[model samples]
Target: MNSVRYTWPEGKKCAVVLSFDFDGITPYLWRSRHSQSKGISEKEQRRFGPRQGIYRILELLEKWEIKGSFYIPGVTAEEYPQAVEAIAKCGHEIGLHGYLHERVDELTRDKIEETLIKGKAAIEHIVGQRKMGYRSPSWEMTEDTFEVIKKYEVLYDSSLMGADHPYWINQMVELPVQWLLDDAIFYRYVGGGASVNPPANPATVIDTWKKEFEGIKKYGGLFMLTMHPWLSGRGSRILALESLISYLKMDSEIWWATAQEVAAYHQSLEVEGKNACLTEMIDR
Candidate 1:
């Protein structure tokens, strides 16, 4: 491996990719059972659901002057074009999340491709452009997911089933996989949150990210945060978000950009023939 690394964007120094998975943008669309069988309140689920999360995230991004990638379900985008429009206006990248919040592990390869194409179309119609990125619902990616993503020539995959660092899948080195973040798997599973009163150590979670960001900055790569619209939208989680951004903003070493911008920057560098990784890529 070459000791040299690719330089980040002109004004940007390190790469800090904060990707949000805005899954349930509407209360009605939430797949959580409507029945009170489980003793979960509809209001509680909806309040902590996708729409609220997205709104909170948008405000936070605006406050921090940061940009991020938002993966939207097709139905979510169709139902909430205003939200989509706001994201576009705010200059955040929008990518495919799925038409329904169905997990990909249960779906066939054909179904996956169909969903990808259809969802991409619907999202494009709502957001007014074809998104180059794709993230699976529930972090449920199958073996065939990568093949289909490559087939679509997707610029990247911020999907959670990946290694610590970013790397190419198939013939393209662009669409690197994204693993985990605080919103989706962390607050829900990583901690002993038997009740909301005493959740995971917030500082530890923040430090985990701080360490991840430091490594990415040190090695010149990979700080993909998988924030969900529903989870990170409220309470202590939002404060955690604030802390993370405040820390990052203190040092302007990273490029706080949308996913598309990051992909485009890497693509441009690949075109420039300055990085050995690109030079060795014969397909380029």
Candidate 2:
């Protein structure tokens, strides 16, 4: 027999989860849009500085005929409630990204608890739902974050690059932290990481993304990509972002649901202990 034994989620058609993280709906960057961000360090400010990025993301989703998840911070909702309304009106899922998009590196357990609680309250008050998903900033999660997530009863967390597929949370496997993310691949991260520039050209980003998308098609699984409204909100990058949508529209078999839908489906299957079929079907 071949030594390359396939695990549970091998070659499955993927279920793509298009997730937008903190700073999108929030107007924290509204001022930056008007003038050059002065004095502030590039790394420190870029995280929250994307006022128009939201509009561009909305346009991209509409073009793709896809619905996405928006994980906003508590301060974001408290600050820009109109964007919260717009997100709901546009028919997208809203999740929590904490109160200020603060990373675990900078917080203690008490602070994380305080911020997360505030974030949930602000999002629910504005978006009209107890947000179901949570993503830590920069995927820089601490041990405390997990305990807090479990405490809040979040359906799933998407900040980790732990797998190439959406494994059942708490199920324990070598899997992707996020099923789809645009940060490292498209958006530039500090320290000149992969996000600094995608491995290929702007046009190629979609091509590579589609290659992954096609893998999901075969396997019947999910694709989770991250994007920032600031960069993709304008210029040639718009074409780059839109191309993925253009390609996704070609396939009708794909179900463009929120992260909640996927997590719920998998969790329910696991609870009833019908995981074998679910796994095989998801793996396609």
Instruction: Give the per-residue Cα lDDT of candidate 1 at 60.
Output: 88
What would the per-residue lDDT of candidate 1 be over residues 1-284, giving only the tens digit for each residue?
Answer: 65545477675546777887776633234444354444344334544544567778888898878888888788777767778888888988888787776678877999888888887887888666664777777666666887888888787766553334344445444434444354544665322243454445666778888887887677676577777666677677888889998998898677776777766766666567555563454335
Which runs of model 2 end up more than 4 angstroms from their true locations? 1-12, 24-50, 169-180, 189-200, 218-220, 276-284
Local accuracy by lDDT, each model: 0.68, 0.64
Overall local distance difference test of candidate 2: 0.64
**Model 2: how large is the Cα RMSD against the reference?**
6.0
